[model samples]
Each structure stands twice: as structure tokens, then as C-alpha cells.
Target: MDYRMFKHRMVNIVERMKAIGGNVSEVMIGAPASLQQIEACEIKLGFQIPESFKKVLLEFSSSCNLRWVFPDEYQLAGELDGIFSGMLHWDLALLKELNDDKNGWVKEVFSNPDDEYDKVWHQTLAFYEVGNGDYIAFDLVDNSTDACVIYLSHDDGEGHGYKLADNFIDFLEKWARIAFVGGEDWQWLLFTSNAQSGLLPDSQSAKLFRSLLKLSI
Candidate 1:
């Protein structure tokens, strides 16, 4: 999608997620980061970020600041996990220090070695970090136009996460549809593709969403 389309979709998701939960203190969308800043960040990370994801951040949020207007709170995980905000770091060298193998920080955090990382774990860079060591990330090595969005677990090496959506936008659309359930939510493991909450559909949180928001699911 074009920058305009990406921006529009992101705005809508931000609005929908915020409306779902009024936890403003938790969500933190930032100002736009300069192209130079984004380029430098990519160099530091040693991988090219997907354009679809890049367009959204470049047109919307800053490197480490909050957007204040939208998608600021999509974090929705432990303490509202920030996406692009956490994906990037203003400090260039910090990338290596953070993801280095010495700290046991797995560059390839996802478990399914063949399917997820494709054995090129070092090429993967996590953009969204769940406060508890998990992440919502994309693989740089993906040759597709829109990179695949994958989940990464800090603790679980065997079953960290698998390919969720084909692209970032699809991922956001799914999250928004489900009221942006908590990041790395237990319900996540329940879905093969789509995520539901209560047992009938998903969790109690999802049931509450259905009753209060009147969602069809």
C-alpha cells in the first residue's frame, strides 16, 4: 500500500483501539521520525525494515517519542507494548548491545526454525517488544513485498511464535477486530489464524468486549 493508505489504516486502528480502552497513560504513539533517522536506525539494526512498516512510522511516529494522535497505544500487551516505538532506538550502537548473542538475546527469537526465521535468525529484527521479553516483529530476510509479521518469545525457545499475518496491516486489522487483546495474550495460542477470546469465542475480556461493544464475534 501507499504511504497515504498506510497512514489512514493506522489512524483508524489507533482510534478503534483507544475507543476500546481508555487507558491513555498506557498507549504512546509518537511523532514522525525523519527519513535520515529511519535510515540510520536500519543501518544500526543491520537490516532493512519493511516499507509497509516504515511508511507507517515515517508518516506517523518519531524514533522514540509518542505519536499522541493514533496507534500510540496498540502496545496492548504487558503495560501496552509499544510497536515502532520499541522497534527503533535513537542510539545506533545500542542495537548490537541489546540483541547481541552474548546476552543470550536471540536475534532469531521465534521457535519454528524452518518456518519463522528460515534459518537466517540474525536477519530478523524485532520492532515491537513486549515488556516481558516477547516481541511482535518482522523478518528482514523476507523477499515478499510486505514482510511477514511474526511473534517472538524471550523465554520460550521451542514455541516462541509463528507467522501470524502476511503483512503488518493485516496483523493490525486482526488485532483491532479483537479489541486489541493484551499483547502475547494467552488467547493468541488458541488461534491457528484468527484470534478469539472466551471459550465460546475467546477469553472473558473478549466476552466483555462483545457485551459492551456489541462485536459480532
Candidate 2:
């Protein structure tokens, strides 16, 4: 929990929201997740959680929003939320819902499951939702242990969507550098591609994506 970074940056964002006539909350740094709760989630995920991510849940707020009160404006810059948008609401119920939901989404997206097999839903530690059915998750299937942050579009699997960052903290820091706008699904694509693909400059998702693409090919 990089409390130092939040001191000036998040507080400033709250001030910005207030200046914009947005109804803001009281810097809602919600309660940290109990070890029991995290362990329960890990049991459901079928993978050990990343230590960095686990730390965020354990020491800091498990899930919270540091943004505007309304949904529309929140869509642009989002809340004081650490960029997960609605998906940041990684509540026990939501976590259960996503983890339990294996086949329902598969059935909808993969029209011919038997004929088409790239992996619409790779084993993922989805920490955020992209509004649509896609997710910003850790690639539980490939790099589950350390895991770079990757985008999981509904129709595309491992080989497709971009890998956003090398790790959890990097993801937040980079987005914070970009004012959380780059955290948006589209903004990520636009900047990374325009940079000839590495918005974080050291992002390894590109190499991982290439390797995954080979398997799919």
C-alpha cells in the first residue's frame, strides 16, 4: 500500500472533482479484506494470489471508489477508485459471481465451442470489469504466479487484447501517471499502439501476447 503516493495525488483528484461540481465522497478508504475473506477468494480462484495484489487487499481497502458519485462522469475519470471502475467493487459476492460464472459467458460468446477454441475466458484473476463483459485480469492460465495485467475482451482470448502492465502496482502507477484515462479499455489500446506498443515502456505483455498468439496459431 503506497500510502505516500495517495497523499497528494488522490487528494488532488478529490479536489478536482469538487471543483467540477461533482458530488464526492469522504475519501472512502474502506476496510481492508480480512485474511479469511482473501483466503476464501483464493480457494475459489484456483490459484495463489499475487503477493502485491494480495497486499493491496490485506493492508489497504479491498475495494473502494475515489471518484464522483454518479455513474456517467465516473465513466470518464472514474472515482477516487484505483481505476477498476465497477470491477474495483471486488466484493465477496461479485468475486463469487465472476468465479462461479464459467460456462454462461462461454456459451454466449463462443458460438461454436467445439469448433472455436482459443479461450474466451482464460483462467483469470479478474480484479476489474471493462463495462462490457470483458475484464482487466491477471492471466491465471499462463503467468498466474507473477501475472502482468492484461485486458480480456469478451470475444478475444489470450492471444488478442493488450497486456497493460508488468504487475499490479505498475498498473496503478502508470494509470495514475496518465490520470487514469489510459486505464480505460480504449485509451489503453490507443496509447500503447501509438507508442509502437508499450505504454509502460517496459511492459512484457507484448512478448507474452506474441507467445500466446503462437499457441493459438
Best TM-score goes to which candidate?
2
Name model 1 segments beyond 4 Å from true.
1-26, 63-103, 107-122, 157-159, 191-217
Q: What is the lDDT, from 0 to 100, of the residue 60 in candidate 1?
A: 57
Off by over 4 Å in 2: 22-27, 68-89, 101-103, 111-117, 155-160, 182-184, 194-217
Return the lDDT, model 2, position 4: 64
| Candidate 1 per-residue lDDT over residues 82-152, each given as its tens digit | 22221112222344454553124542343345653334343565655555666656655645655877666
Query: Which one is best on lDDT?
Result: 2
| Candidate 1: residue 139 lDDT (0-100) | 57
Worst 10-residue lDDT window, candidate 2? 79-88
- Assess the local accuracy of residue 42 in candidate 2 as a C-alpha lDDT between 0 and 100: 77
Worst 10 residues of 1 by lDDT: 82-91
Report RMSD (Å) for each prediction in the order shown.
8.2, 9.8
TM-scores for every candidate against the unseen true structure: 0.57, 0.67
Report the C-alpha lDDT of model 2 over 3-37, residue by residue, as the tens digit.
Answer: 56844656665555565455666655667898898
lDDT of each: 0.48, 0.54
